[model samples]
Target: MKHTVQRDWRVTRPSRKSRFNFDQTTALGGLTVALFTYIIYHFIYPLISKGLLW
Candidate 1:
């Protein structure tokens, strides 16, 4: 005679505070920084260069 054990169909996964992934967060952060840099370079820099922002 042999004994067998059954496992749950759903494997338990590690819990998280949020569903957002770290990779996505990093990607979004990078994109945001890039956008800000572009804005500053193309738009704000001209104002600063002409001393219009002062």
Candidate 2:
């Protein structure tokens, strides 16, 4: 028995540009930090302060 693959059935991938430049990356990083800080302040900080962080 012989197995063969077709050349026409190729997978194509998307190309990447300079979408993650310094400004964009920095903005995203800052946003992520702010979001994490907000979550900790609203969720974790209260629990810890109330001694319910067990």
Candidate 3:
């Protein structure tokens, strides 16, 4: 029995330094905002509601 494995891969030498992709940047920005809001909702909102923080 003969088994053959097919591979598809490519390697390239980039001519210039790659910048952050736009879609990735947007996704990161959204994640950051969501985390920040969640932090406030989880920790800071409770403090304010109980009159412990202004």
Candidate 4:
């Protein structure tokens, strides 16, 4: 019987030139605003209306 050897997987790091243009602060700020707006309008508003009686 022939035995097969499994090779270890390795992650390749990207070059500096291929890095993101936007800084972490800007990226986080944009993402935070977008997520907040989406959750408030689509999720929170609907749930709030359900709990109110008029």
Best-fitting candidate, scored by lDDT: 1
Query: Could you report the Cα RMSD, in angstroms, for every candidate shown?
Result: 9.5, 7.8, 5.6, 7.7
Model 1 spans > 4 angstroms off: 1-22
lDDT of 2: 0.87
TM-score of each: 0.57, 0.56, 0.56, 0.44
The weakest ten consecutive residues by lDDT in model 1 span 6-15
Alpha-carbon deviation at 20 in model 4, angstroms: 17
lDDT of 3 by residue, 1-54 (tens): 889775745546645556955578899999999999999999999999999997
- Give the true-structure RMSD of model 4: 7.7
CA error at residue 1 for candidate 3, angstroms: 49
- Model 4 backbone overlap count: 0
Candidate 3: worst-modelled 10 consecutive residues by lDDT: 8-17
Which model is ahead, 1 or 3, in terms of TM-score?
1
lDDT of 4 by residue, 1-54 (tens): 989886755547754674567789989999999999999989888888998533
For model 3 the local lDDT of residue 16 reads 52
Candidate 2: list runs displaced more than 4 Å.
1-22
Tell me how candidate 4 scores on lDDT.
0.82
Better of 2 and 3 by lDDT: 2
Give Cα-based local distance difference scores for all models. 0.89, 0.87, 0.85, 0.82
> Which order, best to worst by lDDT?
1, 2, 3, 4
Candidate 3's TM-score reads 0.56
Residue-level lDDT of model 1, residues 15-51, one tens digit each, is 6768776788899999999999999999999999999
Candidate with more favorable, higher lDDT: 1 or 3 = 1
